[model samples]
Target: MISKNVNSLIKVSILSSLSIFSAPLFATEKTIPELVDAVNGTLDTESREAGKKVKLRNHAKGFCTSGVFKPSAKINNALAIPLFNQAEIGVIARFSLGGTNPHASDKGAGRFMSLKIDGNNESLNFVTTNSQVFFASDIDDFFTFQTKVKQGAEGKQWLIDNKPDAKAFFEHIDQMLPSSSFANSAYFGVNSFLFNTYDNQITAGRWIFEPVEEKSTLSQVQLAHLTDDFLKEELLTRIKAKPAMWNVYIKFAEEGDSIDDPTILWPESRQHLLVGEVIINGSRDDEAATLQCEKSIFNPVQLPKGIAPSADPILNARAPAYIESFIRRL
Candidate 1:
């Protein structure tokens, strides 16, 4: 019989390779303000019953951690330049649950991980999720998806009207199982980015953060008994025991791959580069740290030299929404 750990590994691998969920639906053209408003509207509608808390429009609830990013041994690739060329820079990271509910259960369907690398001139920020694929393709589809989700009965009708998008959304949700600890899970950047070398060589790719330790999932019994703040508590305990680490890799897209659409996953055979490692030294669970993390914006669009976002419309729309969220919270 297969061992329990082996069974768990198999389950995770299968979930990672699950088929792409949604196709890119026709999106109506929208300005940045319009898109940001739609996103805030969804968050406001969802949080109506939760009472008055400064709800984060997305990745609303999180715990902060202090760490350092050590670059790879040699800088053979373009992407490695930013982290490796400089001294080991301090990093502030936030691990969060997906959605607007600060009191969301630890067993909720989605999780988020974001990191900001502190630098002298400009900082680099990367935001990733537990799943490799996103539910929508562009700003338009994102607005539609969020609007439908907030509409209740009307949302159900909208999903029925947009059958493929609905199917994809649920399929994506099916794979986002709760993990036993934040350090035990892998995170992915669903959107593609353009990596430019000093020599002007350009390549398209996505980011993946693989935990050094094997991932472990909570049993159904454990999940059912978890506290509302279980994820944060678990991370605190784990850090005290040992530093959590993740190897950073970028999967490069080949000619035919869809760089602009995040809903599609690149093939497993795609080439990947090990650019660096992220080591979490301690948890930033104090009230001051929590406030700093919550108030600071972590937008994927905030890139340093040598790295830029792809033409994915959804990618382009992220900054404005983040800016709007930041201002309103302050």
Candidate 2:
């Protein structure tokens, strides 16, 4: 559970970045209640009594958070092959749903994948979702979304009750490749960067990962029986069967781009670059030492070299809170 003091700092830091928040619809305290119970009206999950009691498992790569190790892990330099630079890098990739249940799968829930690339002298992190954009840009909207709805409720009813511009965002993903199918879709870092590249202080981009096997888009019904550990099993299957590979690519955005607005899209076809790859050999899948690599902590803040978080507000928020929440379990 990273730390309360650090989390408080994160919340305060998010508050200071108000100009970057895009929720004009719920800008006032009268419209959207201030001091929301993120416990979702149980009004006590934020308190130490229940909060401290929550159980979390730590990973070698990341700490405990929300009671699970999650799709969390800290990658090391030995695992990464640099694209732009000559040095090897490490990366953090996190995946999870927003629901309260630790057992919930990617079944019907909203899933997010955040990547923290540790390169020479800096870090580059890409926080993404199954949908194109995010539920909110700044921390306020994020807290509001967390407080307003109970996860895994009636999806439509929940949408109507709390009208997030999330619909518009999903519509973008649907329209972009309506028939193409991201069933095996790769992701991009839609925000701009302020990396360690002095020659180019501003780097706006996207990151993509291509799976070795061809599979259809997994459905909720199928996922219900599978669970989040599905990825673990799927990878294990590959190890028992053969090798599996995923290419990690980054697409840089143009200068002055709005990494702050989670809603806006960086024109991918116009400005983006493919950065690198992560190839997983079958060798480590069954080994205990292999699993040990997962226990190391990985945060965007844990930059090693020429990569740094962009000016994107979400990037800023994730930097501290992610590592803090992680330390709880690690």
Candidate 3:
């Protein structure tokens, strides 16, 4: 989405930072700042394309809701995090479409569920998406893909031609139908994390919020009749009548499973445990809360304790990128 003018500006900005990317090409040793720059550049390009005020780099169109997280009995044995040990935790969540344009049509766009579990001393966040696997596995690959996308159709075609995984991911996204409500769709966490038990046994796992409600999808006729901003309205009306819920499941990683590469999915046969449940009761009324949800970056790396991030380069690179994106809007 970069115009020639923005493209030239970015080239000038990154000229001095070439070495930062060069040294990390193979090792996936991308620094936080470098990743931040890459993310901000993409956001700038996207904002210019949208012809709108600066907003989130992605998932810009979303709504915030207040809720409570009830820990399942299984959670105590699964992870050693004290936050989860609590009976209930105050939670704030945002459901959004996957795009830089805040006012774009929601149809066919990817969805995101970002949740923050507020605890006494520390807070945990899960920035989940409606996909089992991501497009890129490492920082270098993600950066390259972002760069390619900025080049427009030809650059995306390069990915389809050369990168099989990226090709498959794009195909998956293309086939995804629009859900009638956010409450009906499942949300998957792309990155894997280590669940350290109090007994000192560590297990690698990823999480998914499986909807407690029946799944619903929009028919072609219905989709044709609805407006672009129907989702927020539907969700707001739905929540007023009844809360939406999801059962949290931790998919345990088996031996030989790819722990670091988020682009790879673990076998369906892998054991999964129901560790908790999320109940979004109502939309936030406070303007400050709304603004915070809209503006603040939900950094997944911000952990409480007992849980640790895997060696996934893409996972580690997210925080810095999100921080940069957050800073640019302010």
Candidate 4:
């Protein structure tokens, strides 16, 4: 039989993963400004629920780091993006827990990795998460789910009764253990984007960062012994020994795949193109870097000339909400 501690961890992990719900507000036809208001209002509600002055509206607990992204030799030939054509791009990355509460425990917590790449004349940002799929496909459904979550116990029951995918996600998280270090876990850009080749070949794909190091997870027994702040310290110590790295790839979608809805997972048989490697040589965990991370807005829809946004409503709604969050925090 599973112990009470393990059961508690399972509940925490599932709740943390669903805290932000990985969706947006409003619809594709709705103006983004209206979506922005809805997003801000939800975040404000979350802040009030936290009962504390949180720094970030979501993914509140995290640490910043510095890295470099080396493009593959095949990248420039395939894509027309200026950033990927360069030799090496400077990277500022933040690893975070998926929750509104800044004081949430790290053990069995859901995770996110947001990256900003600096190029010669263009910059690229990737807001990724550990989950392969989101809770909702579009902003309208996501807003409904968010409202359901806010409605208390009865609403949760309604989710279980109506949303089979969400129920399955919760069940999947129950058996999972917390990652030993942030360096080893994989991250996924759940939203889809259109990538254009120099030869005019266009492909719809999502970004995935697979860790160079093998994944390590803590058992419930071991997790119980560690404090809430262990992940950041563990990552800093691990990187100090040697650079942590992840291989970046674009998981291409084929015909009949859902390009706009992130809730649907593309089949594993789909093609995956090797892009490059991200090497983390240093960390910027000081107070100033923390402040900068808080102030900075890592918008997902912001792309270079070679790349274009998909028709995904959640993808389009993200930027305005991010901007509102940035402004409110300031």
Candidate 5:
């Protein structure tokens, strides 16, 4: 019999993965501003009856407001040079709550940060969260995780069996997801890009970013309201006061290493090396210019050298999804 702890973890992993759904499969060729207009327009049309509670707690700063997801404008070329080795690139980050419910609050319990880093030659996109392990393995599983949650277990297996790589991925699901979340689970690109690195073949991976701060659960009493600009107010307050640093690292899969399997786990025994620290000095854009900085996209596959992506199907799906979404939105 499975232990209660393990069973709980399994539920969290699967549930979370499903909630982080809706990848752009096929997007139209639209400009970024046009995309934004449409997306925001759709958001306005959403049914927001119950006031959504979004809590954001920074060091010293108390929780407040639903973090607003806005358009990124500035491209910090100088910072990119040191970290990604790219001279210049365009990027955008769309922040949102992970769920199918259109009425999800901007300040939901969990949040997602999608970054698109444009390389001089290529680009990379990363979608990450506070939790380490994802609910689903790939885009399809992403949907399956949701179906099972809404439909049932038998329904999930049925969908998987119909897919070509079903058995292999399904067999790996047990190992891919722990009954509970990893002491802290993480996300990698799980796909590869063309790089000078030899292992770039048949291998793809995702990047993981952990908060230097420890996890101390916040209760309803800890929650507060900051209106809409909660994230901006909090993040800015922290940066304005002291230099906030986050360790950034990569975890990769090797050639012929199930590049298509999004759930495949790369060993931490191969611990991700520290690339660098992201120091948020101040706004990379001026007040009037903040608009441009917000519109840019920060994709993951946008590698320079030593860093690259794997040739995974997940990568294939993301390539078009992000580009089209960005093209239309940006």
Candidate 6:
């Protein structure tokens, strides 16, 4: 028979372990708009500290470049939509640092690329980040994580104490190294989308833009010495010497794949099809062009006829958040 004291201690131990695994008591249900507002609030605070400039609530600082996407002659799959069927399509690509700070250092851990493809009838927008997976699984998790991150050490501790998933994401971000240049970094869509075939069949997949150039990163010392806008300068100079390019591939989901969870990375064995190449020939150096690109909104869900968003809650939340941000910025 166990003693009363032993029973009490055992219960305490069990409760302690449970607390580590469970989400924080502070976690509350948040609507989609509320989630976006929380994120934008944090972003606004950060951007203000960096400089007094009116920028996008997120991904505020970026450089624009003109490119072309040339599709393969034969996709050989029914998932090839009309956009993919086109011989060549014009592209407006934006390379950005992954924060609202317009004056963020070039060596920041997050780097992103957003592409706007001009199709025959409609346009397709693809946004990707250097990391293969997003930090959160859904809007609520995203809000919780972002909120905690804004709180600094105490917030991070809250994540470790309550949100195990978010704790893992923080660890991943800490381990990530900064990319040397936008041209050499591979970008991943991080969200899943549906592809409708001409035959009325549908497949789900994610997009990856693998750079033709070797992926490389600068050393910490080298990164520390670079200018705040070194990424933009490097990209401009590199493309002038030789056009930068990426091989576009789509990774299709299998029966057991997790389409809704952006935090879950698909298996390496998942099959991918080469759809086309994105070639950045020149920079949009003019102020007017840059301003227009900055003002434009890149919607991942703004896909062509054959493409649609998956059941991923995060994907569903993006349109509303983007619209809110657009309206506020305007």
Single out the weakest 10-residue window by summed lDDT for candidate 2.
Answer: 63-72
Residues 1-330, candidate 4: write the lDDT tens digits: 446686466546544633453442343444443344333334455644443244346677887888789999998877877778788888888888975667889996477899888788888889998878677777666665666665668876787788875565556566666888889888999999999987889899999999999988888899889998898888878888898899999999999998998888898899998899998867444435444665576878778888999998788778766654444443
Summarize candidate 1's per-residue lDDT along 44-90 as a digit string, tens digits: 54453232245436666787887878877654455435545775767
Top-lDDT candidate index: 3
- Model 3 local distance difference test score: 0.78
What are the Cα lDDT values of the candidates?
A: 0.73, 0.44, 0.78, 0.75, 0.41, 0.77
Clashing pairs in 3: none
Model 4 weakest lDDT span, ten residues long = 32-41
lDDT tens digits by residue: candidate 2, 271-323: 43334454333433334423443343344444435455565665555534444
**Weakest lDDT window of 10 consecutive positions for candidate 6:** 18-27
> Please, what are the lDDT tens digits per residue for candidate 3 over residues 21-60?
4354347666554564454444355544443244436676
lDDT per residue (tens digit) for residues 1-330 in model 5: 446686466546544543333334323233322222222222232321111122111111222111111111222211232235543344333444444344443343454555544455654556665544344445545544444434557755765666534445445444432111111223334443433333233223456655444433333343343342344455556646664334556555454555555555566665353544333334433332234433333445555544455545455444333443333321
Listed per model in order, the count of residue pairs whose N, CA or C atoms clash below 3 Å is 1, 36, 0, 0, 56, 0
Q: What C-alpha lDDT, on a 0 to 100 scale, does residue 273 get in candidate 2?
A: 37
Predict model 1's lDDT versus the native: 0.73
* TM, every model: 0.82, 0.61, 0.85, 0.83, 0.51, 0.83
Query: Over the stretch 259-282, how does candidate 6's per-residue lDDT look in tens digits?
Result: 998988889799888888999877
Error of 2 at 22 (Å): 23
**Which residue runs of candidate 1 sit more than 4 Å off their true CA positions?**
1-27, 42-56, 77-83, 153-157, 160-163, 283-291
**Candidate ranking (TM-score, best to worst):** 3, 6, 4, 1, 2, 5
Residue 298 C-alpha lDDT in model 5:
43
Q: Residue 82 in model 2: shift from native, Å?
A: 8.5
Question: Top model by TM-score, which number?
Answer: 3
